[model samples]
Target: MAGEKRDFNTAAATWDQKTHRVRMANNVAQAILGALRPGPDTDVLELGSGTGLVTLALQPHVGSVTAIDSSPGMLAELEKKIAAQGITNVRTRCVDLEKDDLPGPFDLAASSMTFHHIRDTDRLIGRIFGILKPGGKIAIADLDSDEGRFHESNEGVFHFGFDRYLMRKSFEAAGFVSVRNRTAAIVTKPGPDGGVRTFTLFLMTGEKPARETEGQ
Candidate 1:
């Protein structure tokens, strides 16, 4: 969380009022987890949990989740959701992922719509791989393009939104094998000025190969 971190605390307060936005975000979050296809015993770690929109969606499919975010306000919202749902397998932590050492060896690591604010995506991805058990998977879902300054005044680092080439290169350089990018239908919605606009979201998936078994 650096560069221009969006204040999710503010967003959380009004998120319910924004029906279209909330539904759209939840839909995307669900889709990200759906694609991961984690089994019942998988241990997951989510970066930038942001109110547990994705964390809760993942609960039914995995053994446990450790959700991390930088904002206490956002984490508080997630806690409320957890309590309401009677979910006990989810844990939340507020910390800056860029500078913190997270406990890991997670079977799957995920982050959604959070990379744009990061200054070094490569280093971050490598750190993720280092903490994952060999053969673990990583997935990141984020904006494919800024859609013409949607938050011109407040947008964060946002390096390569439309450039999958650059993003894939960075993932591979981070030591992830079998990296691939998936593009989904452009999401169209009404802008602040009452005009419709479209933006594409991309999912990047990668894997760390399993270690060679002893005596192989």
Candidate 2:
């Protein structure tokens, strides 16, 4: 975990220069915004908000956004962007999700291109569920399963990608209803062996079921 943080921190200066990553983050943010349609009163929690790509895009629409990442350097970069844009609705935090508690009970929880780094999918889903208010929503965008060649290095990657069917089951088990998933984007890149590779990204959304009333 420490090594992964170090690698991300080291890459913070140039992370936004990767066109593919920027495109992916933009697509994911758009999907999330469309799905949630956040208003002035909505509160959002963003996980793995590196360099504020999605975080900045989201702040304008929601009431407040708490952006959390494990890398301090990444958060610093995000903070700079937030300040430059005069985006006061977003706050950045450096946290290790597995070990630290999140400030939440948010109206919506979202993440992009980050779930693959987490090894315990079920536990993370449950944690997200726990942090959300009843009837709250979650929108997560990540690469679908692929051959292990998409990433040149896998130092911090816990899963190459994810399987939608299993991921849906995990969401259901975490007490989310109205679960839906769709292909959000497809990114084609050069493979290590000089071959063309296509990676499919999916956006999965689920809502925490509202509690039933006594006499309804």
- Which candidate achieves the best TM-score against the true structure? 2
In terms of TM-score, how similar is model 1 to the real structure? Answer: 0.87
Tens digits of per-residue lDDT for model 1 on 1-216? 125656777777555575544554566656656666797889999998887777887888889999999888888888898889889899999878888997788999988767877777788888998899989999887778674444434455556464777878888887788888786335677778888877777888888878844773
For residue 43, model 2's alpha carbon misses the true position, in angstroms, by: 0.7
Candidate 1: residue 139 Cα off by (Å): 0.5
Per-residue lDDT of 155 in model 1: 52
* Model 1 clashes, total count: 1
Off by over 4 Å in 1: 1-3, 160-162, 212-216
TM-score, every prediction: 0.87, 0.93
Q: Highest lDDT: which candidate? A: 2
